[model samples]
Target: MKRCFTALIALTGAALPSASGQGHSALVQLQAHHSQADLEHMEEHAHYRYVGELLFYSSSFLVEEGGVERAATEQEVLGIDLHAHDGLRMVDQRIAVHDPLIDKHIILLSRNEFGALVLERLSPLDRDAFLANKRATMEQPSSKTQ
Candidate 1:
């Protein structure tokens, strides 16, 4: 099995509203493709694409949809809504949390015929512990680094 991924950086990406109600970050588009090895295979490869966005508030970021704040599950990342096609198929998706001191990152993972980690999304973990750490950092005077 062979696979390829293409990321389309939006030239005019939409801005996400921060916790302060101001737009700060841009949403990026991502695409994943998979094809079979056998030349006899008649079916075309499968392609998936979606726009990724994250909302920052206080000291953390969360996946936002229609102004609603929530964690991005596996389904939120790779679930295709388009019409069904013939060829390889997406097998499964998973979400994992990685905690490193104050910075906790959440990773979205997907599996398909191409490979186990066909797609992934790295995002900040939204939790009280992380929020507190971020808030403290934000409140600190900038002179410390100077």
Candidate 2:
């Protein structure tokens, strides 16, 4: 498993390989080659099936539930917490992330004293930008060692 990761990192970009593994990074990479509608449909379907859901996209989450539902603005969210949750034991294991057995990151963009703020924002990106960043990242050197 580690060897595979090493090879993938070597093949892709080396810089910030850790951050590149975050929830959003997957979407960015996929969207680089896919249509936005297809991406949305898949993520929404994944959420419905309790397979896997996107954690963040600039502001929008691939799926939303309970408290954290959407992309939040600075004023709308004072701070955020990324934790783990053990649901009904259904969410699929993504990229060898043995979530339920291990701890998964559950993101929270909490409300303020007034109430949850209605953020006026756009989706962090469309396919074009995602691909551009991905291309750039792939060209960078791996800075941190495994």
Please identify model 1 stretches exceeding 4 Å from their true place.
Answer: 1-12, 18-91, 109-146
Predicted candidate 2 versus true structure: per-residue lDDT over 1-146, tens digit per residue? 34223323332243333433442343443445457666556444322111122223222211233533333333221223212322222333211112232133333332221011111111223233434544566777563211
**Model 2, stretches more than 4 Å misplaced?**
1-80, 83-125, 142-146
lDDT of 1 at 29: 12
C-alpha lDDT score of every prediction, in listed order: 0.26, 0.30
Error of 2 at 132 (Å): 1.1
Question: Residue 89 in candidate 2 has what lDDT?
Answer: 23
Worst lDDT window (10 residues) for model 1?
50-59
Predicted candidate 1 versus true structure: per-residue lDDT over 1-146, tens digit per residue = 12221212221123322211211221211212322232113112112211122211111222444545554332332332211211222346433343332233433232332221112321122123334444566898562311
Q: How far is candidate 1 from the true structure (C-alpha RMSD, Å)?
A: 21.0
State model 2's lDDT. Answer: 0.30
